[model samples]
Target: MTRARRKPMVAPKLFSEIDRYDEANSARLGLICIQERIPSGYTRWDREYNLDGRDARLTCISPGEYGGVPHGLDGDFATLLNVLYLEQGSPESGEVHTTAYQLIQRAGFPDSGQYYQSLQESLDRLKGATYTASESWRDHRQKRWTTVKFNIIEQIDSDTEGGTAFGVGTTLKIRLARPVVQSLRERYVKPLDLTFVMSLKRSLTRSLYRMLDAHRYDPANPQEPAAALRLPLLQWARECKLVEEVPARVRRNLESAHAELIDRGYLKSVTYEGRRAETIIVYEFGDLPATAPAPEPMIEVVPDSPVTEALRRRGVAHPVARRLVADFGENHVTVRLETFEAMIAAGYKARNPSALLVDVIKDQEGKYAALGTSALPAAVAPHARISKVVGDEDVDALSATLDTEFRALPPAEQAARAVTSVRMFIGKELREGHYRSLLRAVQAGDVDALELQREATRAAAELRLPEFAEGLRRAYSEP
Candidate 1:
């Protein structure tokens, strides 16, 4: 007899304190590693600040072993938090037992080798990491910042006895530290869109997105549909884990990451104000538009046409084909059909042809350009306008390398080149906005243009794009 196929398991939604809009866990959480790559060995961070007239101290210790602290709490760790919290029925619960496959599925990760590997890594980091916070009130409560210590996960008990394919049976018994559990039990968590969080490509962008999303205006309160967060440059830098002491470098790094958030539609706009001693950054949250209802299916039966036949042959539904022909003129339909056929011939898969065709018609010219193709008439040479040039993919790859390259430059040269590299990589509109924001930071005495320029020259040499780098250098060097 054939063995019964195991039914697929469904994971539940994950939650976190950072998911909500609250000041408590706002500045000092050591949960995310803001760097591009995990640093080797244990990393420790400590800071002291005054919030709402109360003095506070925050300290985080990331163990060297177990892959260091997590890159951020959004992706895998967020999923793990959800799984553990849900299993215990309360965040304050000390310990719980579960299997690796259960956590992976619950976290919404694929049951694959790579995902399992990542799950193990997150578990290791969580078990080893620790956080502490101390606060003293100004109203005669305490003079110095008092401290309380806690671990994210106090301990992990693993069992790998039942051998299964891909190590799926590895069981984990986890104990969450009391302080973290209490914070969660007290409703210090924010509700977030896990799908949107996962969609963000960069960790910094993801963290910033969550912060802004937490501050989004509640629809129930018509008087205030949105909220604005004003963060001082130094504090912002500390919170973002961008730089330790330099405000100018912090501004440069923030503006670059902010551009990505704006492009992804997570932010509406970012403004900056320079003061004599500090720069202030203002973040504005945009309203997420309600998704429009699907269009009514087309009912008309059109006359026999090549476009209709072509669409039908390509598995486009009859109603969708009719709608395309009716909505878009015959010529537009014909061109898109040809392009779609070309893409198919070139091994491109149109997973949702109906939606893809709609997008294709809407941005016809840009779509062709984006696809690295030219829309030429059948009479003209088809490959005439298909010139060899750098594509977006190449630019994206270069952009990632640019950060590492910029960091390698001398400290004096880093700020300026960082700004220049951002301008070159992002779109024209976004670049302009970023420059304006930087100028605000500069005028407020938060950043120095001369320093930025000095760094740009060194960065240019490193990039080996002297012309482009020098052009930017000159622009900054000039009045």
Candidate 2:
């Protein structure tokens, strides 16, 4: 028998400090400033590859490359830059380009190829509404060459793009290295778990180290009898001060094994239901400052209209009336009615009858007012009839409905201006009787009902509704 020679495994290149920076910034791939210049000639304009290929005319800067830019948030620009490098090639291909990839690679990343691929996919997914390129030359008479610059508004992926949860805290940029991913694979994570983890990994891990450090446990004492160290590191980290907050669902799962954490000296005490429950026996690891609570945003409530003099004659509580004035705006009796309803919903149980009466003023100057829900017609009706009787013009009705519903919620002051800007949303068609009914239903938690009111007002014309639509979308969006 002959002995077989064994092959030695090659050592992996060490991950670089720059790799850490890239991961932290979510800019692992690199960034590029693409400048394309083409003399007007027989350059093949591949309409098949563009968004509006055939319909699009070829200029000095043609539309051959539409889906080839980096997008998805600010830091993701690095990834976008990386993708452009891979797809478009270099000046060797006769296309002008500049990149920071070579600089990044010099920093030492074993998995630079994967990082490059992430960049490529991100850029390839880009689609643009319009593509414009400028043609200019510094010395036009001498060189006779075009210095072209293309301007693109790339599409953004909201999910993968990093976002702040509390809106007050610093954003976490997640870029999991190949090593970390491998480690995760070796643990309880399975193939199905890989899919699940990939979906959540971006948000759950990015820049979490500092937070994890905050909550790290000391090994001195064991609080629970069944402590084991094989548990998830994040579970222990959450128990420590490193990550002060976990999603509600995750916290629930931790409760069952919390005692085990204590037994392993990974936790000292867990707070629950207004009391501290000691689970871990040890406290020697030293204490961390409690996580700072996120500050509540300030709100400025203002009435849309002036109050009637008759109401002033009755002498309502000056502070309470002023509060209403500030919250509901000056000219809007409709807003005033809505504000009162909001106060009631917020647990002001001793209802004020006077507030309701003051809310339904006839407007001495003859500005139209919305009839309360009690006054709505009993059956389906045309827009013309509704407008004649109640003055519910499409635009006016849209504004009034949005104001009444959105103002009642605790939204930021900036949101108020944004919400009432839309003519109508596509979601207004679901309600049956009246727009007011849909508004009230929204307050009462009938989400589908609210969409119906919005659908009823969808217009066929171009609209000045983007800002309002954004606010409305945020308002109804699930947290």
Candidate 3:
């Protein structure tokens, strides 16, 4: 078998925005679904219960030869689903395009052979698993609780024009199920702060975050996202597919996950309403941080009519706009909108303009921020992207640009940024002091741009990266 090549790791861009639909509630494959290995003959998962006094049933079955429904690691497919929706452009958009490696990076997993194989397996399980939500699912289009059957992904095919997942140059064409597409058309089914969700340490915590966020947020009133949610403990366990009904067992199962979320600031507290199986788990959300914990809360639910309207004018739904302004403030939301608009004007084709706009507002990639005049690099070119090298001239040009940018900063600030930047690319602390000196040498003209690039590239190769020059260049960029 041919070994899959390693792609260089550039700094992860902030532009990776992910969203999901509420219609697919209770169908969390890996998060809430079984985590154990599936038996060869396994084929289905079914449960019947009451959801808010309504009869609810959930059924997921494997339509393909692949068995046991989408369980275990298939949970990570949530990342792929959000990416698909972010790029889907429209509920009517039958398909979206992405790559295996892109999904892997967004998943925050290491870029290695094992993960590539894991990605492929996850995709197969997701494509094969068909979920049937009976009253448990919401049909936003019809505005009613109804029985709905759909696959999170209707089909997955290798893009003829693009490489498949196992190869270096790969793109996957994913057909979205009709229901999912319909949900995408809505103003806000549920847009996840995937950056925050993905940052969680456990799949269990990640799963809890998604389900709870979906509950706390009310799409119709974006200005006031729900801050608290309460659910029957046993019902919640059943909803999460945690088979244990004993209150003690359920609480024990959730104990660590709840603690992790609280410590991470995603949850302020988790309280119980009763003892034993009769208990009701009450959860309150913490105030949104922009991303992680910035000094100025990056994301907070503030009400702003003007900003919300601006988003609406740009084809963003009233609710989504409100949600944007509510979660992220007016300034951040407006700048990103203007930037995306400017990029479109500059002939940047967007499959989903609204979705892209939503993505950009919350930590967009620097490359996409060019059209806006908001202290962003006028034109931060991708001089050395993953797996590719630039000419000596390109490297020299980047160095010159960095020099000019550096001169404008105070000496102390420049030194601070340089140290921080160099440390990130070095990957290991053992080499930190050496790289600091090396970075100073380049800044002070003791080293040329090409040599520094090669040195960094060689170091990257030691870590199994094919072309790590991207890291060397990206290290200097602070965004």
Candidate 4:
């Protein structure tokens, strides 16, 4: 008997790198436009999109060949760029040979007829879609601006039988355009977690992730993370395709997006500087402790109102009181204030009302639990077990010991030890029961194991416990 030939198994590409800031920064500033879906048929137009910043400006103009502003290009086109970026042998080589199946798998798309159709459509769109970008950068010492125009793909060479075998026997040879290739060669790239980016389902969420990844500060630099991007609410709304939405509606969308990002471990927290219409939204990115205190819910409160007066009476500083009243609402503040007043009336002599108030609010851990909100303040929550193992005292002691040891070691040994120390600390949290609780939550169906694992990984980075995070991930994945 003759046996049928079996297809060779393909290993997962798993990761890819791109000029992290290139497309993402442009998207954040309203330069690259994304559409939810491709139009039913071809369309074309010309338009200019502007990305204005404190020290830089980027202007993007859509070419007339492809439908005005390459809609939906960010996802598939980005995936293609990542593939090429990863596979390229040299900076000068622009041609990349990949099978349709390989592209589908790498792009995180399903291997199906519909997906194949969509991929072909995307390729066509990308071929015709071209844009020009004018970038301006300025500082105290110097300023510069430059412009470049390029197509997403300079050319595509393909070999395939026009049969109904979904992408079978199809091979694509893609040559990336010059400008993008040059950008990559010039080291205008930022590191990205391709797995994380590809896993995001929504186009907007993916765009935001790219933007955050592009803007993330290098952790090794030992400086404060980059300043939060502050964008006027209206301008942000326009970029997010909510230009017609009222301020309240826009705020709702922004909050919802922020919560989603926080849950996914891409955001530290989101803060707004002003109220309604004039609001300046700040997107802060960093690792956050799992036990961080929750943010006060946004609610309406009059400026300089009685609530502020009551807080002042309680010895809360003016700025602190104003922030609390604005964020937590009059009703919530009044309740807390009443509780404090009642405590004082009971002959309680308080030396620090401000600290006491903070403690009281924190003690009521379930106050906002019912709201199902994830974005929270950075106040450290009390964790008896974790505190014992990786407390501030332990961290300080470890730092001091490392510093002393470094002085005694030769340069090569010191460098090795420094890397090993960071690696060791990232796994320190494994000793606690946090992973047990996480596993239980996953088994109980309260959360997804993969998502919980991702969260643990992110938290471990901040908490300096990588080994523990890896072990937990293994536990979740293993039978």
Candidate 5:
């Protein structure tokens, strides 16, 4: 007699599938994810490299207020900007429309109101960062080197008011920087395997994978991805923006990322050659036993892990499963799985079973807090989460970063950029008339653009989601 297949002991997930994203030009800079952690009190970074036989330099300045230079989640948000740009029909520049909740879900962040605050924080940082490329900025369209300075994101407009959190459907408009557009128009890009990239837990691994992609994958023959990559150790460290330049320390820094990538099959082996800074790190891609498949549109290039398999069994997509497991730990995820299954056994019907499962795992806003049949250990409590306040500093930090960058721009460009901001006042809020006139001075190149952008940028971030409003109120109620 044939036995029935085992029922999946998990609930279904509800999320729209995001296609693979096209990323261009980031590979050339390779400074976005230099170090996993930016050193405290660090606000400026400068590095010199040779480009096309000419000396070039990259300098990034971040105000100490806006969480230092655009590091960590800043880079991830940059990648997501690319993804969202492509997802929102074809715009390499100009505005791509989206909502905050959609960004969180598509980026595989847990569905929670608290994340809405973090989302805005990352967005603010991206806009706050100023990158100066002295002859290092590759004009891909012109096929020559050029000097330029710009923020990661050009502009932001959102349906926000009253310095509060936004709701799920709050619309947002984000414009891409010109250099990014030029690269895309010139086809200096590759389809990033986000499925694989997002699966890797640490940002270091993700950064390494992207940088290596730049080294291994050629856009001309995008199908034939190279299987090997070799680079000098200390040079690679510099390229990665590692805080510590010492060889041993660099290796120690990359130890975990290297291990994760190898375990995930992005690399079969990573071996070093020679001595000191000149030591060459060689990477062999894929598994020895299995021949690697040609790069696909959304190629994962990874074997299924047990946690991923478990999540997949519950109807979560492969990439999403890995992302969820990576975002939340595997150890406690299994418990979430069991809790979800228990709900199913108890006849708790769900419109989106997988979403319910994830919500249970995330203990999103304590919605499923009381559903626990048995209380988990303090270390394993799913509902337990740290609620970090979006303090005054977080709100006020980027004003300096935005102000300094605007002032640094030449009069002509600054006026042009300001006019762009002024045009956004077309059909906004109650302050449309008053604010439009205020920023119109900047648009006319009369007054400073700092005050207007500072307020506008802060407004964009201020829309607190209804779920977290009470918590925010309580926090602000203190002192």
Candidate 6:
């Protein structure tokens, strides 16, 4: 008795049959297994030379298609394997083979001769079935196989690569297809714009370097290469939605741009520090617009002492005189403080004061600390009706308190207040009676308000804020 046929170790799986056929046919006939959307394809799939060059039937398998045959055929194990031999010539002339197979001996189908039979019987069954080969086929009287006029793109391989040359790149240009761009316009374009800003931080660092170089200054060393200028640059960069950690190369490119600005006379060296010969004076580049001038305290004190005339010959401003007198009651007192400090550090502290004053100017001008001050506190400061005593003894205590308040609130609340401060006049608007209704509308889960919070967080974190806010407004508000 015949030994019982061995069983397949696992049940049939999706694509397992297709996978076996592809591998076996590809290996036997030198067909390629290429990705469906890839930049290349198999010999017969190339199109110019096959008998079925324009047929839809040929093209479907050319790129390869999926989904299994219907289950109604039951245990029938047949496949039609078409190979367009590229080494053969044109449709009227070359050898093209389309063979039908009745696959047998798959261990799971041991008793199924009905499924795998002779080619004649297979052809009869296929013809009897509703699905016949899609295009016209003719039996060759002079050759062993028949030919079909199916859609196939063929190629001529060149001998240099051991096969005929199939111009895949050219054919793709003539016949390639793309999914519609309009269909993805909203889904792709919006997130791409958002991510665009996220990627801009790197670019902004280059701008910072140019801003630094516009002043005719060079980084003295790598460790503090930008120590002289980084802080203010960083502050403004943040305001522009640029952040720190921009690469060093970007920093250098910015420096070079600023240098170009200097070369064009948009910037000038305005003042010197240290001895007249040893000093360095930095200037802003002219290509860039000048921001509001940095603030300098305008203190006027005329000393009633003769020594005031003596100090006047020096370039010292009178404010320095008053600060000296205010710091120390006598001119001699100012001299003593300077002399002692110099004796200890030998002019190091005094040397950098002018540069440090540049920062002090920008700070006092109100650009540096506005988020936690000025526009913010000015909003509610009038309505709160609260006055807490602030002392010069504690310096920035008032600003500090206000900053503490601003930081303590969630970003969303801060954003709402910011919009309110700029747009709403409380008594005029609130007194009109629609104000509370509007406030409730915002508070009752406003989408606009939430969007504003996201924008503000991006602005504050990336440092873009109101300047870049306009660009992003259409992002959330569009119909």
Shift of residue 443 alpha carbon in model 3, Å:
35
Q: Write the per-residue lDDT of candidate 3 for residues 1-479, one digit (tens) a residue.
A: 43444333222122122223333343332223533344655577677866568787877777546655665556656555654554433424556555555666667666576776776777777777788878765555566666778776778854221234453223455776776666555533444555666666666766766666655544333223465788899878766666456889888888888998787766789999878867999997775444553221112233447777676666665445655676766665655566565556655444455655665565322223222233223331221121022334544565567567656643323333333333323434324334445445554655554444334323322332223434444444322
lDDT of 3 at 223: 25
Mark the regions of model 2 whose C-alpha exceeds 4 Å error after superposition: 1-201, 205-335, 338-479
List where candidate 6 sits over 4 angstroms from the true fold.
Answer: 1-256, 263-265, 268-415, 418-440, 443-479
Which candidate has the top score in lDDT? 5
- Candidate 1 residues lying further than 4 Å off, grouped into runs, are 1-30, 67-70, 73-75, 82-84, 105-112, 136-146, 161-166, 213-226, 243-245, 251-257, 275-277, 288-479
> Which candidate model has the greater lDDT, 4 or 5?
5
Tell me the TM-score of each prediction against the true structure: 0.46, 0.16, 0.56, 0.46, 0.56, 0.14
Worst lDDT run of 10 residues, candidate 5, spans: 7-16
> Candidate 5: what lDDT?
0.58
Root-mean-square deviation of each candidate, in angstroms? 24.7, 27.7, 14.2, 22.4, 19.2, 37.4
Q: Write the per-residue lDDT of candidate 2 for residues 1-479, one digit (tens) a residue.
A: 32322222222111110011111111111111111122223222211111112221212222334333222221233333322222221111111122223212221222243443443343332222122212211121242212232222232211111231211111111222222122222211101111111122122221121122222212111011121123233333332212123435345534444443333333455443221232322222112223542121111122223453333333332223443444444544434344334433444332223432342322211112333333322221111232444355653765666657544533221121122112123223222223223233343454443243333223111121344345445544433
Clashing pairs in 1: 17-189, 19-190, 20-190, 41-64, 42-64, 274-444, 413-455, 416-452
Query: What digit string (tens of lDDT, one per residue) describes model 6 on residues 149-253?
Result: 222112221111113222111010010001111111101100001111111122222232223322222111101111132233322222222213243422442
On residues 1-479, what C-alpha lDDT tens digit does candidate 1 reach at each position? 22322323222122221121221232124345554454565367666776557777776677776666555543345445543453233423345445666665555455566766777676667666676677621111222334567666688755442343224535455776665454444333334445555555555666666545543433122112243578787776665544344866666665666887676655678988986347888887543333532221122223647777676565443434554676666776776555545544544433334334444444322324233222333332222232223345653465456545645543323333334333432214233334545534444457654455334333321222334434444454422
Worst 10 residues of 2 by lDDT: 16-25
Model 3: ten consecutive residues of lowest lDDT: 380-389
- The 0-to-1 C-alpha lDDT of every candidate, in the order given, reads 0.48, 0.27, 0.53, 0.46, 0.58, 0.26
Query: Clash totals for all models, in order?
Result: 8, 46, 5, 9, 13, 25
